[model samples]
Target: MPKPATENLIEFLSNIPFFSEVTKSSLKHLTTVLERETFRKNKLVFEKGSVGEYMYIILSGSVKVHEKNHVFGHMHAGECFGEYALIDSNKRSASITTLEETHVLKIYREHFFQLISNDIGFSQGILSVLIKRHRNIDIIQENLASSKKALELANSKLSGLIDGAMDAIIMFDEKFRILLTNPSASVLFENNDVIQRNLLLFLDESSANRIQNLIKNDLNNDQPLSSNYLPDVIKVIGSHETETLNEGTISKWGDNVTSFYTLILRNIQDRLQAEDKIEFLTSQTEYLKEEIKELTSDHGIIAEDKSMKKVLQLVNKVASTNATVLINGETGTGKELVARAIHQLSDRKDKPLIRINCGAIPTNLIESELFGHEKGAFTGATATRKGRFLLADKGTIFLDEIGELPLELQPKLLRVIQEGEFDPVGSSETIKVDVRIIAATHRDLLQHVQDKKFREDLFYRLNVFPITVPPLRDRGNDICLIADHMIAEFSRELNRPINQLSKEDKAALINYNWPGNVRELQNLIERAIIISQNNSISWQSIIPQGGIEQEATTLQTSNTIYTAPELIEIEKANIERALKRTKWKISGENGAAKLLKLPPTTLASRIKALGIERPI
Candidate 1:
């Protein structure tokens, strides 16, 4: 028979470079200690979520490394894994499996732990593994970079330099094409993306002609054109590059020779009028628009309706004042979006805007959730943790569903809002924060105050500049406007090409009384887009509440407008279907209620009244 398989593996191991230098006595011991294990083709050596205790060294055959939605990469012989765990003792990042029958040196961490306890050199070897792997990565990166062309590297380096530079910078190529723009450069151009675009795009005909003439003159003189111009506020918020651009002429033509010049516009209103709010959009709701645009961007209302637009105007007016703003609106009216707009429009845009839904968090944990807790604060408090309020210091804290705050915790929140002081659980020290509060609620706080459930003092503090966002059903023409935007958004997100919504779907949208408001409308649109089999989204594709009953009645009575009360049954049915699809989960915000765009509280109410099972 062949020399034992273990002996053959021992012989193979002696030839590998990383361990080849070991003495014969050490090699024999290492061989004897390592258990030889065979994994057939496609056998799972380790999985992404398992707790690992062994460092595996591939001696024969290869394995694949795969990340979610990423390519399947390979690891060849002499490679090892379960290595990072040795350093931080964290969970595995990805799974590994053999492509063919494989053999590897399985070094159990327990055995290595014993070795480390007894020998200092063995400990050093384990530490050296991480150092060696890091060095190998550096070498591979350098080798790949060395093969890159000088021009490409120069361009990449220039981009990084521009982002870091205080002043804005813009570059143009010899053919008058836009080459690059830094963050500060965007701040100069009305905070818009003009980079990689034609130089002639942003300017009017007169300005373009004037620049053409000036550039032509500069080329004839073989000099650079220098002029002071008003920069757009949009550009300032966009890029933080250099304020001046230098474009040396390569080939200057006669009057307007084939040439490109880099022009730097300065935000003239920066110091004068405070153009921080210039980037605030008052068109369609940005949240819904961004959703349609496949961006997880915040929402805002730039209402033109005299009543609602006043909220926008007020938010802008007090935004720089750094005062607390309490916004009250119905469930789907975009309260958190307003909070974000306030933060962005304030001086603390660079800081976090931590948000918490007071109602969703259990009353027992609310104290620890908002004020943090020390290690051993309670049974599961194994480590010290920072709470939402502490994390939001120096920035803004948006408390959504503020009315749902527990009756007992209400006083502590009142103290924080009024005195800016809070104590972590089981800690004697009171932490003071320089935080701005922006609270929102769909419930009637005045009633809660009367019932002695809410603190009136806190209400008055946050109600400094009260803002009310209009419901989606009340936006008139903006409904169609938002729908078109959402269709485009969901199409891109789902990677589907839904060219347009069917007339029936459009009619249904307009007729349907969106009790959940804008949020509900957006969710329904997304659902239709995701389920649409064709390029066009139709009403039938939308699974409403009450199933066939709702669909038949809604389609039959398409001529009649749906009132909130009338569609109550239909909404209930749709909610049930959503819950079934999600296996009756109310866990993450992506559950049936969230997917339906209904407030979690509101969804819960319907769930109980309808006897829908709660999976928590």
Candidate 2:
């Protein structure tokens, strides 16, 4: 018998997406036709191929929709089903089973038709449900087909990979029963039938026991295991040969119910043989490089400091590549030496390495020097000469003090760096050169970029692999090493017998903060060699009294410390002296700009900012 529906049922149905547009009056009549029903767990609500009678709307609990024994989907409260059965006379396409005690509102075919007749919205709702069901079914079918195709492709590739593999691949169940074996795995078993056989039958007793324990541990693990039991070497007994396997590992596979352990083995005999040959070749190459380095003065680089060692390591890495390298450090910090090391370690070692000091060249002659001028192109123009770029063709160009390069020349440099082509001074022909550029600068190029002095694009281009060489103060004991080398050279140059540094001499050298870096140390060592009568060098005689320690001592002894005004007074005096040397001329050759290595406009701005004026 069927129960009567309630007004609450019609109110709930009105909220459903399919029936939300229907009038309240129409929904109220629908409640009179819908009978509220309840079914117990494991009860069959409908069977496949059964006659179509009513559509069900779940009010509570859950229902399992399936075909045969295969479950397709489930419906909980607030969901509707079987609307398709009401419109057609065909049998039910899927059976509905209750998973738990469920409450439902059922509308029989005759009453459903009555509700539709009063309101056409009911008919459209039924049609909407039918269309949606068909579309969902199509999507599921398409996904199933696509998934099947993907699975087939993956399986085909896996089969090809296993068959073509040279490594032995064996898969066994938790019980150690061999489930499958590739051709490589089977070969080790003397072509015997391996499937369904005990894995211990083929492997050595010790190896088999170890592998058995590993598999048991993996099975007992509750968390997801990626892999386990990586063996350095595993000996496996084969028909013709006893195979020594390297990189052997046992990995987990499949699900918990039908879990498997896959054993993968690789033979590294050929790889080891090749590694030995490579090691021998590398040693011979290093020996030749060392011999060449011993013949040079700086040996390209000395890097005893940790920071400098890291810089050298980076240089070795980037040297192989064609990327532009920018070395940054304080003046006399061996930035140029680092650049030279990169070139020496590179493939361009056989070619010339033309050096250019941007700050050394006069502003007026810089363009002509970088891109050679034609004969008679400018005053005192010499015969046709190749520029630094042309001379460095098929090699490298070490651009020292790169931050001093003029703004006007930066674009041309950028063009040449990016395109490997440049136009010479007073010439239209574009000259191309394959030159590796290694630029070094003591100035903060980034600050220059902020001041609009250096091009940002050019900075990025040169900074592809930036290496910062540590200053001598940071190099600690490396100062002694550098001093020793300098002593030998200076002794040879001066015809002196200075061979060693005394304890006091070494302590003085180490104690001072080398503001002038390695160059200052070399100068001191050279002076010491010349003044010393005995074999040992004198520290106090050569070393200056106005270094970092002297400044500290002076400050400590003074009653009053100097302020900003005093420092400014000193700067003002220096500027005035430079002005006098150039006769108040701020630009052009022998002018204040050229003397200070500052642009004319920059010098003018500084003069205005500092309230500097020429003497009457």
Backbone atom clashes (below 3 Å) for every candidate: 31, 0
TM-score of each: 0.45, 0.43
In candidate 2 the C-alpha lDDT for residue 497 amounts to: 77
Off by over 4 Å in 1: 1-307, 501-508, 540-585, 588-616
Question: Tens digit of lDDT per residue, candidate 2, span 543-609?
Answer: 5433322222334366454444464466567777888999887666788877976545445435643
Deviating ranges (above 4 Å) for candidate 2? 1-300, 544-616
lDDT of each: 0.67, 0.75
